[model samples]
Target chain A: MIILIIIGMSLVTMIPRVIPAFVIEKMQFRPWVNRWLSAIPYAALGALIFPGILSVNPDKSQIGLLGGIVAVILAYIGLNVVLVVIGAIITVYFLSL
Target chain B: MTDKAEIYSSTAVHMIKRGFITGIPIMLGYLPVAITYGVLAKQAGMTLMELTLMSVMVFAGASQFMGVNMIAVGTGTLEIIIATFVLNFRHFIMSLSFMNQLRELKLKWKIPLSLGLTDESFAVSSINKDEAKMEKGAFFYGTIISIAYLSWIIGSFLGGVLGDVIPDRLSQSMGIALYAMFIGLLIPSIKKEKKIAVIALFAMLIHALCIQLGMSTGWAIVAGTIIGGMSGIYLLKEDVA
Candidate 1:
């Protein structure tokens, strides 16, 4: 059943996550263990974000490609994220038109 | 003991503030996509109740979009589920990393929180070290999930109703919002590293390669994440270790 699969999948997903908490609840790890753990999140974040932007255009054409560049520039400068997304969308729309 | 309790209570407030601040990006990203997913799910022939159930239970943005697309194309239920799993595999890595921070939470809290974790929450929750490590499972999970859950419900409902009228180009363009939010999330952290430059470069390269290989959109994400992560670990392992 779909319900069972959802539960099963959810459990399978949570196991690697929740098991560590139970084991380490009362224990303290070395600072390095802590630091390495901290490093993983940012690293994972970089892995997740970079590809989404750069993967826009394979041929490096003007429309899709330029839109990605403009968005990245705005994003890099700490522009409002929502604005940057809209800017890219608008730019791409106009270009395609 | 009373002093410690007071401190914990104050820290809980701070954690909630931090969690709320982190949800801003999700708000920006979720609005358009969730709306589109709603519209698309409707277009794909899902009934109102079925669409709501998918949003409530799955709660994943991209996978849900892809799942509906698959269903639209007549993909079987089993295949749709498998595709979703593979696409969401990054959450597996995200959850494992958060496990260290979550070391103090009780099982009752952890079970529900972990189920609610998604790409957006994983990104938001993982960035704030203190929030990520909060042993007060109820507060931590409660704050993150509340924002995410509220946004999905509102966005999905709006999209389902209004999606038909929205233009095609606009719907396609909204895909960029989630990615843009991600860049905003990474700015503060990426500024901290020289090696991050290299890892990002490698991620782009791998992504480009994956596209060239004619892989599906979902598979490309998986490949790029694995390569990017390993590049970071290899580059930072010595310093971190």
Candidate 2:
């Protein structure tokens, strides 16, 4: 069962990725669809990042927000992803102290 | 061999080598996180072999973490399968976009490329695609993904061996880094386009509201993305135009 579940997981993840490249190589999405697709990067990033921020238990009120803000600032200046994350973690740690 | 053929082969080889080296930083980032995943799976009563196989087969961080939870609670296999499938459904969108970008690449490359299409790898691969005049070929992406794959496997082994070496405080704090990484990814695009900021803000608001109202994470994200993207089509169109 475990192995089957693993295989099933692999199929679901892989099929979506695999089918498009091979099967739909010549197809182009409609303009509206393309618009929606372009919006995906931002929308998806926002959804993933925002709620998780609030869920982190706060020491002071909404303390994690500071980390989020710091991360955004660091990232904006073209800092590497690793550094951006480390900066946010360090900021939050200091705020906790 | 003809000079043309030799040059082509060397370029391909060079791209692959460059890809592997570029992947090193992503490998570093993934190592600790995959190790964290390993630690979680271990806590959930996974045997070392089972955990190793799970990471190998799944190769997805969010799903693996959730799969460990489901397994720990003795959830049905279907539930585990369904939940992971749902969590990973966004891969459909990502793959579609990525595939279109690779019009120059061959159909045969799809298999391995798809398997390696994690969020981080996708981002890195796309950047390579954009920066080059020539196509970032199958072997280049394969090399990039393989480095990440190898690092993940090594990280899991270390985690299983170390067995919760991270202190409690540090562990909880590490959670913030995931959000931080997401923010880092978005900031570049947001800097490039004002419209993206609106979409991002709306998506965040909608997803948080959905979660507060007790919807599931996967569905909430899907809903938020759709709504936010739709809003962009209507609301930000004027600004963009």
Candidate 3:
């Protein structure tokens, strides 16, 4: 049963992703359809960062907020992405402690 | 056509190397979190085989975490599947977006490639999409996905073994890196496009309000994406006009 659930989860998780790859390109999409597609990443990332990050930590939950701020500041300045992530993690760790 | 084929065949190895190089940072980034997953999974009473199976089959971070949590709590199988599907609905959008760039590749490559489309690889692939020929692009994407896949599995397996030794505080702190990476990815786009800024703000506000109104995480993310993506398209249309 557990095995079946894992398989089912994998199938459900993957189908939405895999189906689109095969289908979307076959249909000649409009420019705005294309634009909205490009826009999805930024929109998804933006959405994930906000309310998602806000509720992350269990202890010292405020650290998530501060960490996000640190990330925004560091990323805004055009630091390397790896550096930005490290910077935020360090900031969150210190402030939380 | 022959020239294009020749060029593609010749460039494949170089693109793979580039993909490998691009994947290194993301691989490094995934290590701590993947390990954290293993450690947590172990703590949740999952056997090593089960733990490995989860990482291998799922390969998604957030969903795996939720899957383990649900399993521990004895949530219904259908519920676990649905929740995970919802959390990962973003990938459908990602796949569609990437499809435009990857149209030149054969169906075989696209199928496997989509299976490996984690958030990290998608960001890396899209950011670097236009740098080279289309085949090269596929190889680059393949490399990134392959390396990330290898590292993530290894990290999780090791964490399952060594999770007992890692201190709680350090493990907890490492969790911040993924969020930081998301911000890092967003910053560049926001710098290039003012419309992205508007879309981001819209998404964030909608998501925050959804949460405040007590919606589920899945629903909140869906709300945010639609509002954000629609507003972005509208803004881009206005800019073009």
> Against the true structure, whose DockQ is highest?
3
Query: Where does model 2 exceed 4 Å of error?
Result: A56-61, B17-25, B124-133, B137-140, B231-241
Q: What share of the true interface contacts does candidate 2 keep?
A: 0.62
lDDT of 1 by residue, A1-97 (tens): 4444334334444454445445555567666555555555555555566555544433335555567677778768778655676777777767656
Query: Which rank order by lDDT, best down to worst?
Result: 3, 2, 1
What is the two-chain DockQ of model 2? 0.56
TM-score of each: 0.77, 0.85, 0.90
| Residue A78 displacement (Å), model 2 | 2.9
Q: Which pairs of residues collide in model 3?
A: none
> Candidate 3's residue-wise lDDT over A15-97, tens digit each?
98899777955787777776776666777777778876765586556888888888889989999887887898788667767
Which digits, one per residue and each the tens of the lDDT, describe model 2 over residues A21-93? 7755767666666566556666777777777686655544376788889998999889987788788777876
Q: Per-prediction DockQ scores?
A: 0.33, 0.56, 0.63
Q: Residue B28's C-alpha lDDT in candidate 2?
A: 54
List runs of model 1 lying over 4 Å from the truth.
A1-43, A54-64, A80-97, B1-11, B104-109, B133-142, B165-169, B214-216, B237-241
lDDT per residue, candidate 1, B1-241, as tens digits?
A: 9999998898788767766765666776777778888888899887666666677767777777777787678876677667677677666656656655676666666665666777777776766555544455357556876788778978888887766656776756655566665665566556666676666567656766787799765566656656655665457755442
Residue B177 in model 3: lDDT = 77
- Model 3 iRMS (Å) reads 2.3
Clashes of each: 0, 0, 0
